[model samples]
Structures are given as structure tokens and as C-alpha cells.
Target: MGSPDPLEWDFSCPDWEQRLRDQRSLLPDLPLDEVEASRAVSIFDRLRLPDVPGQPAFADAAGDWARDMVRAIFGSLVDGERMVPELFELVPKKNAKTTNGAAIMVVALLMNLRPRAEFVLVGPTQEIADLAFQQASGIIDADPDGYLQKRFQVQEHVKTIVDRTNNARLKVKTFDLKVATGAKPAGVLIDELHLMAGMPHAARVIGQLRGGMIANPEAFLIFITTQSDEPPAGAFKAELDYARAVRDGRIPQGRVLPMLYEFPEAMQIAEEKPWRDPACWPMVLPNLGRSITVDRLKKEFRAAREKGEAEERRWASQHLNIEIGLALHSDRWIGADLWPRAVDVTLSYAELIARSEVIVAGIDGGGLDDLMGLGLIGRCRETKNWLGWGHAWAQPEVFDKRKEIAARLQDFADEGDLTVCEDPTEDIRGLADIIEELNTLGLLPAENAVGLDPQGVGALIDELSGRGIAEAQMIGIAQGFRLSSAVWGLERKLKDGTFVHAPQALMNWCVGNAKTEQRGNAVLITKQTAGKAKIDPLIAMFNAVSLMGRNPVAEGDNNGGLDRYLERLSA
Candidate 1:
């Protein structure tokens, strides 16, 4: 089969309204205990809105959609099956997600009925955890008759609300895996889960939270968050993809119900960019006019646009609930816009070698502090697309030196896109062997195809020469403005959908990190201008693209000269 569709990269729930309607239709066939659902809604509705002026009851503050959603989540039941064990809710910011989360936990605590049942509310940071705790505490304090106070012991110091009746307790904590390791939670509310996307151990922590759910069928785990300003990756991307898949009816037996507030696929892919129109903003902002106003958003957007392109992209991502990749800077590599569309995970290294008539390799690296990057670019004979694969290696010492990006590095390591070498020399030898192996297989260019940064490649050149790769094959590529044509050529391939790459997180991160600097008539992408981010792999790709552009291979020519060279080598 061909590669998976590039559109799958966008995990936005475009058909959310139809998904909700389908869910509502299933309620009748679900054997739902309306009485239990009604009771849960009633308990939740009794809680007061702490943010409101006079602390109005939740029922009064909640909109119709909120009340119905809460009912479906807590009250729905089946005879011998769990209605929904997980809930993924995505909404824009300023929608009172925290307040609603607090109320949901309160209702869960009231309805537990199980002795010593534990309900946990987790936040990405301590401040957010404390904010949730405060919201719940405020609701408890606002009860005029001391109903909540009399029924539960509010311990602000410990961040717990203990139910006097069943000894059940509700607690709030940050995303510390150590804290969640052994706890048997009856329900978990993960607030702002998008923030924990890059937390290397997020999957492990979530597994621990759901570990006890198999025993407690009534257990529910709810992930509530605003869309992240950066591209989704790691645990967040996994969960969001699964949620979207389940919502779209692709996974018939999934136990997760997704309620995502965003633009539909048609609007998202529209030629006129309807999503940018203010008239369509309210379609995604369900809590508009209540928590946030259109006028406020318009004012903020106006100011953001004036600030710069990156700022405006961030504003749209956060305010309009758009899921997008990073907005590095105004003069970012033109390829940045097309990279997302070039992802094709089905293009494995073996598949590339098997299909390509000839391949060109690029090597870019420095000392232990920098990443050692290798890129392979080839013309596939079958589809005729320019397929590419990239790998990067870093020393363990980088983790300590670049502490700010430690988690991100760990994430890339976990995804197998990055190699953490104990000895920097091992990276040089390993990359050399990889290129040598591909060259021995008769897939690589016969000569003058392997591009390397002119400087800092003495060891690599020596290694490749030792492996029978001639010095003539190792061409030195110039850096800076000299490589502007290669950069522009790669951007053209990406935009034309002729450039394809195997899904590699480190490569994507490197591509996103690249920012261009205009040097006279030529534009240059440099690590110096990209701040602390690493763009070594992308630089390597640019070097390889320059060599590929020089080759005399015609597009869609199955009997190209490279194919004859490969055939003669095999003979």
C-alpha cells in the first residue's frame, strides 16, 4: 500500500457536531440509566460557580451544552458494559474549563458511594493545580447552609476535600509521575493535558492513572485542555489522534467520547480561508459572549498582527483553538509551511533503498555539543517522488548542557528519531557505516553525491574513505548564502508535493527550528539565528538537495542512467 494520507497529520475534530449527534443517538441503545445520570447532573448543578459575582449555582451558570455533556459523561451506563471510560474535551481558552473541571470533580466526589475512593485532578504545573484546588474550595465555602462544609472536610493545606460520609477524597496535584504511581484513582481529571505533551514520562504517568480503571468500571478519566500553540507531538499527539479517530467512527469499539470545538474540515481546507473570517469564529467558540467576547478577540488579533507573523500565529492557535506547528519567526524557511504535508510514514529506509534508482547522502555535524545529522535523498523509480529520510545523534552530555530542551531531547530519543551516544566518535563511525552500507547495496550515487559541510568533517571523511567510498564521492558543500539555491529548490519540491519524508520527530523539530536570514539576494538558514533550537538535520537535507539538483536524472524516466548504473553494479 502507499503511504498514509498526509491529512491524517491534522488531528482536529472537523466533524465534531455530527459525532455528538451520533453519540446522542447511541444513548437510546446504550441501556443508559437516566435516573443515575439525572442524579449526577443534579449534584453537579448544585455546586456554585466560584468565579461568578454572587457565586451563582452551577446549574444557573452552565449553558445547555455543558449540562448535557456532564450528564452524558457521568450518568450514562450500560447493562454489562462501561458507557465511556474516557472523555477528551477540547475547547478554546477563557471558556471556564477550570471552573467546569472543579465542578465535575465535586460531583464525582459526591456520587462516589465507594468507601475511601480516590479522585485526582492533575494539572501541568503547581500553579494550575493550586488554581483548581481554589476553585473547588471556593464552591464548598459558598454554601450558605454549610451543606458542603458539613459533608466534607476542606483541607487547603493538603489540597484535599474529604467526604465525611464515605471517607472518599478529592485531591489536586501537578503532573508528577511519582505522585500518581501507586494511587488507585476512581476518576482522574487531567487539566491542560496539552502542556504535558512533551513531558518524557507522560505516557507512563497516564498508564498509572488508568491502571486501576479495569477493576473499577465506573472509573472515568477526562482530559480537558485548550489546543496547544505548538504542533502536537509525543503523548499529546497520540491521545489526540486516538480521540479524533474514535470520534469519527473509525474505531467502532473505542470507549472514549471526544467533544472538540473547532472548525470543520471543509472550513479548515477552504481556498478562501473561511476560518480566518470573524463571522465563522463563533462556530468554534461555544462559550463566546459569556467567558470571552468577539470584540475582545478582534482587538487582541489586531494587536497581534501588528506585533508580527509569529505572534499572530500564536494568537490564532490559542484563541481560535487551531492546532498548528511552531511559528519560529517571520523569516522562517519556506519549507516550514510545506513540511507538515510531506510526512509519509510508510516510506521506511528499506522501502526507500528498494525503490530508489540512486541516492545521495548528506552529513552535517560538529563537536559533542551539536547534533550529528545524516540525510538520505533519492528519486523513487516507482512513484518518481523525491523521498528523504534523516537521522540525528547527540551526546548524553547535551542533556545536561541544554537543560531547557532536556525533555524535548528525551522525547525525540523515545521516538527513536534521535540517538544518544555515550561517545561522540561512535556517532561518526555509525553514520559512516550507514552510508557505506547503502552505497554497497548499489542504491547510492556512484560519485560526487555525498555532500558534507566543508569544515569539521575530517573524521567522517576518513571513515567513509576507509569504507571504499572515494574522496571524489565526498563533495564539500558551501555553507551560508552559497546554499540559498538548494534551500529554494527543496522548498519548491515540498510545495509541489514531490518531496516526501518518513515521519521523523527530530527532523521535524529541526525543520521547525530553521529561520532564514536575507544575505544580499540570497537567503540563508543558520543555527546562529535560530536561537537555542537545533536545525542540523535540515541543514544536512539542504546539502543533499544541492547534489540531487545537479544529477541528470529525468523525472518519470524508469530507464534513467542511474538505473543502468545500478543494473551494471548488480551484474
Candidate 2:
């Protein structure tokens, strides 16, 4: 129940080898029942490899380090009870994770003491579920003495293996919240957790699966996954963070064991970049010679680097398990790298409005085939930091024409960050309505606060004025080199951590798509340079920041000054 003992790591660590040794030494030394652990390993070892030429022993095919890891996991105990109720194993691709997971499930089924118990293996897709089931079924059929055949009945059609003596069964299933609704599982295995991170129902399904464990004290849950190429988000990131906390002894283990096969913190941040070095590859690769070879990795890495920067970064993320920062394009805006660090999920629209003395609106009216974006930026009364929120609207016809980005647009629509309106004209009205609502809330300034592109906003200006917004409030923000100061200010705010925004997926995507161009000594982000990608939301942010730089609200008197300004406008 206490925090982990102080770590022996510091930035001054001499080399990666020393940091790695220190990390391995920090693993918790819980009470372990050697007898039970050996028995579990014996069951696992008896399961034959399905794919090998002669169907070699699972122990031999899994390699020594993997076998030992399995032994340590199953054998560990606390007060003579199961010490690890949950286990997380994060490794790179082609590491024999699927086969190893199947073996672990078989061992778990054989070791369960409770009669009529149910064990489940959940995969992100049906194909993956079937693959694991085939591996488990093959293991059961490979028993030479008919020990497993006589003890258990394999039902391939239903993907279940039932122990005849105890009436216990192990089943493979794809992620489904309804299937897990009332099922009580003695043990659960989640495969490719990163694939499910983007699923809207992933959290609910996982909660249901783990919730059934209350009746069984010895129940176990295991997660096996590879790093995602996209940004780490949702449940996968949350679980990974907690596992790391427990691994480092920063938090109590609490029946959880984390085996993370990744670079140490110090080595990961090394000036010489040890993680990128071929010599350090073996440090993170426990199953190096068996599942993967350094020669193949080196060859593949060389080819990937030659292809392009994005390909190289993707290869490193998948093969090396290194989390590269978020950048969609190679020539991305300078602020794109720091965008992830500026996210404050707790900053809601209502909270931002309440805390700020004044709010400015920014609009980017992208063409018929692109998104129309509206953004709000406010300066916090106490902290003086800028808080932002944005949403985009697109006509359904745009998706019909732009088939390439249609799926991505649909995903943003599903997340509530983007809206697909029936008519293109509705987007302008929608944005005008938002401004009127904020103005009624007394957050928006009565004049000179809404900044937008001057060229194509005659209709928009009329709509805003109809909604009680003064004509003087709609200021024209010059495009190209003239707006360089705004771009530079936004970059400075991001780097200084003086800017924060709610996690808006649409905005994140737009920012990632932005590419910069230099005009004389100034920098500019233009849609023409961004190609087919939509950077409307990010452009809207820049427009809002440009207006906010004018400081429409007086200093030192945050609330009363804004109230008096609004009162004089109304009179």
C-alpha cells in the first residue's frame, strides 16, 4: 500500500547498460511459491508449437527468457496467494506474442481450481480471435499420450475448449461489450490492446470483463500489445501509464505486474541517442535471436530510413517501441511538436468562458470542398495563459467528392469534433449562432473581436450583424506575411506552456496537416501549401490569436472592465 522505494536512476547515469541493470534490479521481489510456479511452467512447456517443422516443445520454441518470464509471472505469490491478478506485456511486432498468449491461456485453464470456471481470450478483430483459437486447439491435439484429449473436449466451431472433468471452459472472442455483460471469467487475455484504443466501446467492454473478477480471488487478466504508430490515447495509454508507475515502484504493485520491454528513461533521452544504436537493440529485445534477428532489423531499418522520414519514424515506433512525437507531415508547423504537451482535457468550454475576462472568435471559411472552422481563444484572468476550443463543419457533398479523406472526416464526426451539415450554407449560419451565443453569455467583446479572412465574408458579416453582433466587431486578419507575428506568438505560447486547449481531435488533425512557408524573414502557414489536407481549424486559431494580441480588455481590472465595456455598448 505504500509508494515504491526511491529509484536509483538519475540523468547523470554513465551508460544505457548501467541504467538497464538498475531498472531490472528494481523489479518487485514478492513472495513466490516455487512449486506452483514450476507446475505452471510444466503445463506451458507440454504445449507443442503448432507451426514448427517437427512441432518442437513450446519451451524450446519460446526461448529461455520468455520461458523464464512466464515462470516468474505464474509462480509469484503474496501471502501464499496469487500475487499478480493483472499482467501487462508490451513488446514489438513478430515476437511470437500470439503463440505465447495461447500457451498462457492453456496453462491458466489447466491450473484453475474452481469448477465450471470460464476463461476468455479477447482480440481486437475476429481474425485475430480465430488465430489464437487455432493455436490453442492445435496445442490440445498435439498431446501424444492423449492426456489432454481425454481430459478436455475441443470445440472448434464455437472456439472453446472444455475440461470434461471440471466442466471448465476456455473461449476465444472478439471484443464485444454485450458478450461480457454478465459473464464471470476466471481469467481473461486481451490481445493487441493498442488496436482497441480508438474504439468507442473499448473502455466499457474492458470494465465489464474485469468487473466479473470480484467473485474469484485468483482471477487474472493479461494484456499483450505492440506500440501504436498513432498518438497514444484512450484506455491503452491510461493502462500503460499505471503499469509504468507500478513498474518503477512509484505506486504500489497491488496485484499487478508490468513487464515493459522498452528503453530506459535515461537511455531514451540520451544526447548520443543510445536507443537508436544497434548495440543497444539487444537490451530491449528479450527474444532477439529466436523471434527476431538484429541483421533483419538493421536491413529493414536502413531501407525504411531511405524511403522517407515518416516511414523511418513509423519503423522505429513499431520495431523499436520508441514513442515518436506527433507530426503528420515532415514540413509541419513548429508548434505541431509541442501541441500534445499543451492539451488540458479538464478545460471545458463553460470553464474557459467563466475564467476569462474576454473571448475572441476566429473564422476560416474554407472552400466548398473543405471544412469551415470556428475557434474561440480567451486569455485567463489570473494565469494570463491562452485557452482555446474549436469545431469544424463540412458539407456532406465534400465527402462525396473527396473519397480519400472521407473516412478520417467520418471519424472526427463520430468524436463530436466535426459536424457534417446537409448544406454548405448551414456552416456559416452555425458559426454565426455560436458567436451570438457566446456574445449573449458576455464572454465575446461587443466590437473588434471577431477576426476572419476579409476576401469572402460579405455574407458572413451580414449574418453576424443580424445576430446582434456589431459590424465593427468583424475585423479583417491579413493573410500571408502580414500574419507572421500571430504565428510566432502562438509558437512562443506553446513552447512556454502558456497556451492550453481541450483535446479536440479535429484541431489536432488540422494542426498536424499544416505546413509552413517562409515569406521574406516571416513564416506563413497556407492551405495552398498544405495541398489537399484541411488546416482550417488551425488557421482559425491563428486568426483568433491575431485579434487577442490587440488586448481588447484592460489590464489589472479583469472582470469589471469587461462588464462596463459591455454595458456601454448595450446603452
Candidate 3:
């Protein structure tokens, strides 16, 4: 069927009018206050749109979707207290997200009954914060009747607007702890919340922001954001996932009202990718015919596609609200496109051991500031397929040095795929312990069971020697073009449907980050080419692949030895 009109229905949602109906009279969810909503609308009606063609007031410029968002934000109030604590709206870019957010905050400021209270607009960066200030100040400045101008004080340098009558201030700030620290606010508008997801202390900052609201019964939080340019991680992922759950009615509602703009789940999973169709573009674009048009977006999308896969992915993520999946970029590894197809999510450590006849390991990159990656490749007992798993370890210095990927690394840590160690002594010991466990089960080959890069592996060698791993059990794998066979072999195995890996975010990220090239007669993926994207774990996987190709047998013929020794170790 075709999309519903924005004036009558929520076009993006597959459920359509169900959520709005539920919010009206559902128990634990009180009815939306039309009086308070009208009050909020009056505030919006006063705010003029300066840059638009007609210079219409917000009441005229806002579509039903915008009005619905405004009503849900304000109509949750009964008397002077807020019924809903938070409202989350996710929309695509070029929809005036910044301007809409500014208008909402201004209405919030005007509706505040608390004296000397604070209304804050928080942006993830300084530039975003400045833009918010300009839009909000412009709204007041554009008032020809001196209505808002006479009641509020706009301080350009400080980026603050103070209500002259009530002594309340609306402050615009870049993401800072001080915004959430020690201060209680009547209302807060978190602009572009997705951008804050990558901050090192995203959870803590959000917690603090919410924590401050405990004191004010009338407090409200409005989060307006666009789809992230990269894969969502950290706080962004958590909130976005929660919003989806709430919007889908999988989670109970009333406390949080989510207005998510994106393709319906069914259409999103369609075989042909319905979101890619120009006809389906309007499904997610609620601002259609106003802030943006299908033709303009189609033109931009065509340009992005012509540039390369990477550019296209970024554009689709921002515009169509499509979550970025695996890289699958042309310049990426040979197996990049095939990696997702070869996932066996049930492949855990115990599962690997239970299914494998023999297992080989690869270790790479043990620098203090670098991530030390370990890959385990196992030959299946019956299927004869290869099962893969990976783990990574890093020190505190990694977080400080690689701040850009720190949030993602922290996410990996939370999933138990990566460990952050403080003591260097305990770090190598952890890897050694895993190697020792596999050897104890007699699952490892008698010779050359473990493959490691020879460079910067002196410490690992010492630890392994202490655990009684002889030199032959741990062979040094050559790097760069020399290991091309394993590189090509892994791709062939994945494509031939003989090799599959545990569905792991760490491996997915590393695989996506990998860049490959043909060097003379050999295909190679080097750390130098991968740069800061960190493909150490993938290199380690290749090292394991190199040894697995040898087809060596376990010490005890891989018999009843595994269950016996592993149970005893647990005891």
C-alpha cells in the first residue's frame, strides 16, 4: 500500500495509529493534556521562521509530524508536573532537525512555571551548539512585534537566553559534564544525540543528566537525533535500540514516547531492499515536499553511489536511516562481502571444542598501546568445516591513544570479546593461560599448534616458555606478502561455504577495517595499509589460517582427553 498522509498518520511507523491510540487512554499512560498541548502550540505559534520563504510562524511551518512531536513533548504534562520524563525522536538529515529542536526548546522555555529554573540545549560539538544558539536567537530576533524580544535576553557571546520576567535562563552548550553536573533543569534538549554516543564517557554523562532530573517533578528531556554516519555504538546504540523497542511496542510505554523515522521492519528486511527504491524514500522522509524532496535526495544518492561504496554507505546511513552493516567495500579484503554470510553465532569456545577435531591459534600485536589479538581456527569433527573465534586485549594507553575508536573498543569489552588490562604482567599471562588450556585438552597439534608474528613477540615467547610451550609448538608466521596463500585460502574457504566464524562485533569491525591489494602475484593485507582502523585481529586470523592449512593432528588423536582435563581445571 501507499504511505499515509503526514497530517493524519505517522507515516514512518508500520504500526501507524496504534501507538498514538494507546497513548491516549492506555492505563499507566494518562490521556494527553490538550490544554497544556494548546499552551505549547501557542508558544510555537509566536516563534517566526526567519529564513523560510514566507517567514511563517512555527505553527504554520510545522507539519503534523512536527506538531505531533511538540504535542507529545508538552501534552504529557498535567498541572505543573510532567507525566512523561523523556521523549526521543529519530529523523533523517536535511529535515531541519536543528531548527526543530531549537523551536521545541524555546516552547519549553516559554511554558516553564518554575521560577529561576534552567532550560538547556546541549549539542555534541561547539559548532552544533553555536548553530542551535543562532536558530533560537534568530526565532526571537525575527519577532516583528517585539513579543519574545521584550521578554528574553539573548547573550550572543555566552550563547544564553534569559527570561527577563522569571529569571530563568536557556543555555546552549557543547557536550560538557557541567551541563549535567550539580544543576537541576526544568527541561533539557539533547541535540543530535547520536553524535554523543562515541564519547568515552557517554553513559556516565547521560546518567548524570538524568540523575539531575530526579529533584524536579516538572522536568522533561527531549532527544532529537539523526542516524549515525558509522555503525551505532555505545550510548547511541543503547538508546536507539531502546527507542526501537518502545516504538514497536515490545517494551511498555508512558515514560518515554518515541517518534522514530525509518523504514518499517518488514520492508527493511525485504529481499530487494525496499528502502533503496525512490518510491519508498518518502516513507522515511516525513519532511517530504517541505524541507526536502524525493528528486533532490535521489540526485544526492546517485552522486554518492558514483563516488564509491564507502561514500554510498555513509550517505544511505544518514539519509535513509539504514544502519551500516559490514563494509563490503571493493577495496576491502576478498572475503569482506562474504564474511556476514559465513557467521555461526552459536560458535562459542565450548561449542568450538565440542565440534572440532583439532584447533590452531594465531597471536599478533602486543605493543603497550596496541590491541593484542588472538584468533582460534578449528577443524570440525564431522562437517570438516572451519570454526573461528577471536579475542583482543589492550591496555589503558590504547584508550588514551586511540580515542576515535575508544567507544567501539569499550563496546567490545562489554561484550567480553576484548579485555582492557591494567597490569602488563597479567595481560600476557591471560593469553598464555588460554594457550595452556587448549594444550591441556590435547586439542592442539603436537608441533606448530600456535602461530604468532615474530616481531615484538619476545614477551609472549617468555610467558609461553614459562607455561612449558616448546619453541616448535609455537611457530613464527611470516607477515606481508609471504603469507598470501593463507589470505587467499581463507577467502576461498568462506566463499566455498566451508569456513564460518562466531558472529562477533570485534571480528566484524576488524574485517570491515581491512584493506587489501594484489602485490605482484600475491594478494596482501598489511597493517601499514589498514592504518588506524586496527586489523590486528584479522591478521591474527590469517596466521591461524596459515597453520590450519598444514592439517596437523592433535596430540591424543583428539579423543576423550578434552572433557577430562577441562572439567578437572574447573574443579
Candidate 4:
């Protein structure tokens, strides 16, 4: 169904009708209350706070979605019974997105009639997470009840809050896998969601929320953020993807309310005078004249353009709503608008391997403390798609068990597949237990095997070489197998069914914890910080790079460890 035309709805929707009813009730049926009307008018007239107005006078005070969002929150509290369970508001950055998010969070915390309302604020990182904390605290301080300190008990980190009344709690924290595992939250608000795509840990944490959400039937999940200038991933991308589907009417229900403030891809930055795109002023920024200044935008735009910072330019135009990289970054590898769902192919892994003529395996190793990943690929004879044969990962800490890992390697070798292990480490005595097991299984006979060390795994190389393993190198394939390349490749394959993996939880963890950097060319794997107080992405990359190696395969065949299956098919 197409979205109702702006004119047809008559604003009879429950939320709209309720707002009108509220407005009517707020005003008396008597002679005009100049004082009340004037106060409302001042809200629109006075842009800044303090001297700023209290409430919006007209319904058009903000963009439709923005207004609708405010109404949704207001209705959820005061209107009570009629509130929707979920509110997805996607607006580009600098469009007062954060300010609006902060406002809703404040309302949820203060107005709920419950003795203590629970609220959770999540950010992609600690600093990003603190934005909501800072904004909410400021709003409460300005309230009359001394609410900042007296009403809500703020704790060591902004993540925790206690209600002075019922000892109810409100909290804020960065998206970490462990923090939210079994959390029973009443309301969840995510900020700077675009950054979530960079880490897999966020996915695990969010998954826990989805399952645990049933406890509070009336709980709300609020996904609010701007566009991602990088390869879209994580919750932000998920929200935007769903919103676009809603806007296009691809989905029957309009669950998500998207209030995007993005400029056209063809916009030009060097159009003589700045603010060249007139269409940009209103669509991209709600605080254009209020919190953000036109001069500030112009100066930043010129600097980014002159410096040829294409990423910065795209970020400014899309996230900040300023026109910058109109000409440069427009040639993106894949446009954000080109989201296509994969066509379901129902062939099982064994069946796929049975029909393939070539097979190849890609091994991504984790650090001594990281995760080691292995992927098997086989060419599907029918669809020609690169069928995902299998995917596996072992914790490096566990792989420290030489004998156990060796047994696992022996299994791969016994299956008669071309098994490729990145340079074995001292974790298990040069993976001796594994090599011996592989030799016993008679996969490559230990004569043709090679160890790869793209970085300087000199000790590993020496040990493997001493053990009589081949000293072959794979610089070309290894270079192409870096984090950025592997992620992009895996994403494409997964989306296209060119790569398939058996259902495994750890595989999903690696996929979700992997975060892409602003470079738009590399990815960062996150790790727990020294204090274990927080997690960082550098640790994952360290482990991912450790898995690089070269493997000898038959010419023109991408045997990512599927040769055994190909031999079966040939037989």
C-alpha cells in the first residue's frame, strides 16, 4: 500500500486526533487567552532556549516525522493506552536529531506516572553514549523540581540512575555485548547508531534485548540516528533499510517513521556562493539557525573541499546536511539507495559441495587471544554462485590446545579437502599436535603445506619451516584477504548466497563484532579494554591479521579447501 498522501489522512489517525484533543483541552472555550497563545507563539518565534519557548504553538513546529515522534512520546505517557510499542525515527544528523532524542528521553524519564520509570540510553561508544546523558541532565536541571540532583539519583557513570522515590533506575552505556546480555530494560534509546555496524558485539547485545523485551509488554525500542557515511551496517543501517521499505510501501505497515535530511547525490559544492543547494537548507537541518550556524557550516565545507577530504565531504553533506562532496564521492561502489535483499536459495552445504568442480578455503586467524576463522567456498554448478560450503571459528585461547586443535585439523584432512591453516603459532608447540594429526589423516602429507606470514611471523615461519612444511607465499591473495577486503567480500557473498555457512552462533559474533572504520577501506575488530571496564575494536583486527597465509591450489581453481568435495563430484 502506498503511504497515504499528505492531504488524504485528514490527520484522523489516533495520534493526530489525540494531539488535537489535547490542544483543545489545553485552551479554554472562552475568550482568547492571550497569555497562553502568546507563550506558544514565543516557542516558535524564539529559537534559542532559556528565553526559548516552552511548547510548540503549531503542529508544524518541526518536520512531520519529528512532530509525530514528539506526539508519539507524549501520547505514550499522557495518552497512555494508545501508544505504539516501537518508534523508529531516522533523520540525518545536524537536523536536531540528537536534540530531539535527548528531549524524548527526558520526557520518558520525568513524566511517566509510574513511581519509577526505567530508561536506558545507548551510544556506539562511551563518548557518543554520553551525548544523551549530557543532554538529558541539562533538560532536568532546567526543570523546577530540582530534578537534576534531587529527583533522579545520578551515579558514577551516566549509565546508572536511581529514582529517589522508588529507587527505580535509569542508565546509559556504550553498546557492549556483555553489559546488555540479560538486561531487563523498560525503554531503550540508541544514538550514533551508524557506528554500530563496525562491531559484532553490538549485534549480540541487541539480540539479547529483542528476546528479553517480552518481559515488559509496553516497552519501547527507539532507534534514532543519522545516515552512515561508511558502508552501512548495524542497527542504524537496519533501521534505515526498514524505513526505506516502509516509505516505498514495500512493507504493508509503516512501523518506522523516517525523517531524512539528505541532499541529492548530484548536488554541487563549488557553485560560486555557498549554500548552493537551496533544497538543502530545510530538509537537512532542523537547527539550521538555532544551534548550528550557517557561517560555521560554510567554513567547514570550504576546508573539507580544499583539503580533498572526500569522506569528510560526504559526511558533512549527508550527516551534517551541508553540501560538500557533490562531485567526488558520488561515484560510490554501491549507492546507499541500492539495497537489494538476497533471493533465497535452498540448497544444503553437502548438496552444494556435491555439484561443485572447484573449492577454496579462506582462513582468517585470531591473535593468541583472538578468534581464528575459517571459510570454505565451492562453485555451484547450477547457479554459478559461490556457495558457502562451511564457516568455522575457534577461540585462540582454546586453540592453545595443540592436541585438540590437531585432532580438528586431522578431521579436515581426513575429509580429503585441501586444508589451509595460516602460519601455526607457538600457542600449541608450533601447532605440532595439529600438523601431526593432519599428516596422519593424509590430507597433504605435510610435504606440500605452506605457512603464511604477511606481517613478521618470523618465529612461526621458522618453526613451521623447521618442521618440513613448504615455504610458499601468497602475497596477492593474502593482501586481498585483509579485513576490509574480506568483510566486503563476505558481505557480498552472504547477501547474494554466493557464500553460505551452517547456522552457528560464533560465526554471527564475528560478523557482528566486525566494525568498518571511516576510511571506508578497512575494518576494526573490537576487544575488551585493560580494565575490562570497556571494549575496544583494535583487538579483533590484531587477531584477524594473524590468520593471513598462502596456500597452493590447482591453477585457475579457487579451492578454499573444497577440493576433496570436487574429487568426490569427479568420482
How high is each candidate's TM-score? 0.83, 0.69, 0.90, 0.48
Question: Considering every candidate listed, which one attains the maximal lDDT?
Answer: 3
Candidate 1, position 274, lDDT: 69
TM-score winner, 1 or 4: 1
Worst 10 residues of 2 by lDDT: 4-13
TM-score of candidate 1 on Cα atoms, chains taken together: 0.83
Model 1 residue 444 CA deviation (Å) reads: 3.8
After superposition, the stretches of candidate 3 with alpha carbons farther than 4 Å from their true spots are 1-30, 248-255, 264-272, 327-330, 557-559, 562-571
Which lDDT values do the candidates have, in the order given? Answer: 0.77, 0.77, 0.81, 0.45
lDDT of 2 by residue, 1-571 (tens): 2222223211121233454544342233444567877888888887898777888887777755455546655775444244567877887887888888988888887887789999999888999999999888888888878798889899988989999989999999988676588888888899988777666567678788778876776778889888877656556766777777766656743445677777876665454667777887876666677779999999999998898767876887788777654645577788887787799888866667667878898899666888888888988978988999998999976777775566557667867888899765789899988887667666776567899988789889899989988877789999888878999999999999999998877788788788998878998798898888788888888999998888876223445545654575579
Per-residue lDDT of 1-571 in model 3, one digit per residue for the tens? Answer: 1332223222123354344333231112335677887778777876888678667887667655677777776876655566667878778998888888898888877887778998889999999999999999999888989989999999998999999989899999999777777878888888898888778787788788788888888888888888888778888888888777766667654356677776665665454666778876766666667788899999999999899867887888899887775655668886887787798979987788878899999998856778889999999989999999999998899899988888889989988999999797666888899898788778998899999999988888999988878788999999989989999999999999999999898999899988988889987798777877788889999999999999989876556767775577589
Order the candidates by TM-score, highest first — what do you get?
Answer: 3, 1, 2, 4
Q: How accurate locally is residue 513 in candidate 3, as Cα lDDT from 0 to 100?
A: 86
Q: Kindly list the per-residue Cα lDDT of model 4 for residues 499-564, writing each as its tens digit.
A: 444332223223333333435455432332112111111122222222221222223332443564
Off by over 4 Å in 1: 1-29, 76-83, 212-217, 269-271, 338-358, 379-388, 394-430, 441-443, 488-506, 518-524, 552-571
Ranking by lDDT: 3, 1, 2, 4
Which of the two, 1 or 3, has more TM-score? Answer: 3
Candidate 1 clash pair list: 37-75
